[model samples]
Target: MANKDVEIVKSSGKRVKFSFDKLRGSLKRAGADEKTINHILDIVRDELYQGISTKEIYNRAYALLKGKETFLASRYSLKKAIYNLGPTGFPFEKFIGAILKYSGYKVEIGKILNGLCVSHEVDVLAEKHSEFILVECKFHSEEGRNCNVKVPLYINSRYIDVKQKWNGINSNKPLTEGWVVTNTRFTVDAVKYGNCAGLHLLSWDYPKGNALKDRIDRVGLYPVTVSTLLSSEEKQFLLDRNIVLCRQLIEESFMLDHLGVSENRKQKIIHEINKLCNL
Candidate 1:
């Protein structure tokens, strides 16, 4: 347990206690064995400073976990790995598409749709049953960034234009919904606007326990970029070939061969993927 008096600083500039139980619980949830958890706890406890940043603590723990179990460390790196998709936002879009597909939704990405006023390029169009969702994927490379209100306001307007165009067709179409999904959190104003406008907002954590992270976890569709065992160059190799999920490796073991990894490393990657995907 953490000392009640020792305060740790968060990336958001908030001060909190260095809770060992919380850390242990998180590692446990990530599939760390008790032995590994105890080892990590002991190391972290000894290194705990008066005002250590949570990021530093997480880095320290991840390093240790990587040494103990590469796959579990990859699972622990999930949050940061999501942030690694950036600049072009292509990988993030593909990841979101994969999640929607896994959830039984037919998905289309980067489509230029004709709206009432003009042509708008939608990031993702997911259809399931009678519902159609036009998603605007707002990805941020930095942590603590937020999807602000203006984004939804703009997306809602574009959605209205597109829906009006559909009405002009005089044909039956699925009910269209607008969403602004991000890899980070949403601002208070953004939530307020989404509530007022009836827009769907998906962020890292919002709406209690049913956020994007929760949705992804529920489906067991984790991205390959989260694997600590894979080098950045190796990860890019998989990504370049449109391999997004680590689970994909199970089907195409030969893909690992292309990366020139050793047989032992390949077996470890396979083991991690199996454990993570619960297969």
Candidate 2:
């Protein structure tokens, strides 16, 4: 007889039927080869229980991928890797600035701009030609936390104040736009409010085809947290020193020397970085 359907428990404790298609699709998006994906699916299928936690499944699949291809495994852990950006959101803000920079925009992190009624500290300021955008970066270390309506509400309030000031003084310049960027999903209310308020909202998987994850993958700007080869202390070392992106290591080769690992392991780490970054 065929094996009974397996129930997988999410981090929220909600249980649902296991989906091979979903698993395969995510693996593919992470750049896993077909052979490796099949092998992992087979392993998870055998180990399946009546009610297996999704975390367990992810860990198992990641472990298998790490052994086969460390870089692919890193890509698989992109979401968690983002959380490793900081004990605070400062590093994440810098990382986003870097991403925008890669896309040919001039980016500034931590700018103080004058608003209509008050001065505000902007998380990021990006400019391309005459277009200027003020961004608020919201970082969360935990999974499943959504950016809520209040976040956009507050950001829009600040943006309007600043835009009003800019318009009154610099009418010839391009109008300023506002965005609230998060590393997770957004609440339904948040999406509705952002739409109604005419503010741009960028999240992990929001706005259909054009989300933060999609943009990051489009430019191969994977962060250091994705690397399974790097231990927690090693990853922390890089993060503490402001080495957030995988491409940064490529740009500054000396950073690897600080890791103090064997040359062989270091080479493997470099190889993984190249594979993930498509270098």
Candidate 3:
């Protein structure tokens, strides 16, 4: 049985019915080319079965586009491809926002700043009691080797315009810190650049010898997981075993034993736990 729901409806008065052509039209409007559109449709048609929802159709299309190297041809294509991927990207921002919020900060997404002749869009802007934070969200397979340098470059190139427009306001006013969030781990050079630039960097994976706890402290963010949030017993078990670090969870052999759960059940349990806790 399919895990998702799909529905179909015939035309009603002025309302047109759903069709593959409609999907293609939508993709075209989003700036996808004919080849990309056809590729997306092929994936959907092959994977889709009866009763698939329109949203699921978009998700499959986005996933297919994400897998294509050509999708990275331009920023327009990147945005369209990401938009098609449903709300997965939002969670990356929201998770970081939650941590900031928990620490008594205000978080805003997609903040727009109009410069003298250009514009900039910041992913998540965080305002604490005394500091301002700018975050850029990137969901990639591997956090690029230049991920760290990239954040400062982006800030220097794009954010500088915003800053210049504001007429050199002091650091305490509108901008105080910068952050880059990625799915994969960061390279050592990237980490060093972040430290040098006074930027915070967060990723899904941690490097060797740098414990997750250590990385979280260095990045000024916490390592969060659905399992850690959902299961009180599991959380306590980890705490008792000194497994507060994500790297520890991944590297420490005793995690399963500490949780008193077998390896076979861990994956499913982790999935359900993440869903429940929103980690």
Candidate 4:
């Protein structure tokens, strides 16, 4: 148990008392059984120290989980795996497109369109039934970041411009939904403005039960980056080949052979992904 007096620093540099429940909840979310969860908590508790960054705590817990169950560790490290998609938002945008496509949305990414006043480039355009959705994705490489009101404000204006032109062109009126998606959280004002302006805001944990994390968990549309068995170079290789989803990797297991991975290692990779994808 962390001492009530023990304060940990967040990635944002805010200091707060470390809560056992918070840590336990994260572990449980990774599908760890009660006994394993308790064991991880006990080990993490003993390693706790004042002013310890939450990142350190997470690392400790993840290491413990990995040592016990590799699959559990991969699931536990899902968020971190997302961060690894960066240095650029293109991969993140592709990731969002995959999620939407998997969820039955017809997705088009990085399209150029004419707005009412000017031509604009849309990050992702999703069409489902009578609705056409425009999504702008913000991917942050670092943790503890928040998308502020300015983001939605900017995205809203662009969507409004595009919506005017789009609605004018079609005889059959379609519902237009403008969305701002991020890998981080949103500021209170950002959420407020998004709701007020009728823009859908999505982040890792926002929108209560329908946030990105919820969608990923519900659909099991995890990125290939989430595989623990793949090394950094191997993961990058997969991503470079546009094999973003673990499901994609499963179908294209030939890529493993193309990379000249050993038969023994190939079997392990296949096993890890099959188990991770619940196959």
Best by TM-score: 4
What is the number of residue pairs that collide in model 1?
0
What is the TM-score of each predicted model, taking all chains together?
0.90, 0.93, 0.41, 0.97
Candidate number with the higher TM-score (2 or 3): 2
Clash-forming residue pairs, model 4: none
Candidate 4 lDDT over 160-265, as tens digits, reads 9999998889648563799999999999999999999999999999899999988887777788888888888888898888888888998999999988899999
| Tens digits of per-residue lDDT for model 2, 1-279 | 123478888876788988989889878988888998999899988888987898899999888887887777888888878977766888899889888888888988899989989999999999888788999998987776778889999999999999999778877665568889999889999999999998899999988788988888888998888887888888778877878788998787687787678889888888889999999
Alpha-carbon RMSD of each model: 2.3, 1.9, 16.3, 1.3
Task: Give a tens-digit lDDT track for model 3, residues 1-279.
Answer: 322343442221222234777777656644467898888877776676654555556556655544553212221122222222223565456545655565688888778977656978777888877667777776543212224456556655565566566545545576766677665556677778766766666665444435322333344333323232225556446545544333345446457666667766666544433322224
Q: How accurate is candidate 4 locally (lDDT)?
A: 0.89
TM-score of 3: 0.41
State the lDDT of candidate 1 residue by residue for 1-279, as single tens digits: 446667899766889877888899779867899999999988888888788888999999999988877778877888888887655789999888878888899999899989888999989988888678888888988776678888889989998888788656834665468888889888999999998999888898877688887776666678888877788888888877878887776778899998888999999888888777677
Q: Ranking by lDDT, best first?
A: 4, 2, 1, 3
Model 1 regions more than 4 Å off? 12-22, 33-39
Q: Of models 3 and 4, which has the larger lDDT?
A: 4
Winning candidate number (lDDT): 4
What C-alpha lDDT values do all the predictions have? 0.83, 0.86, 0.53, 0.89
Model 1, 265: alpha-carbon shift in Å?
A: 2.7
**Which residue pairs in candidate 1 collide?**
none
Question: Which scores greater on lDDT, model 2 or model 4?
Answer: 4
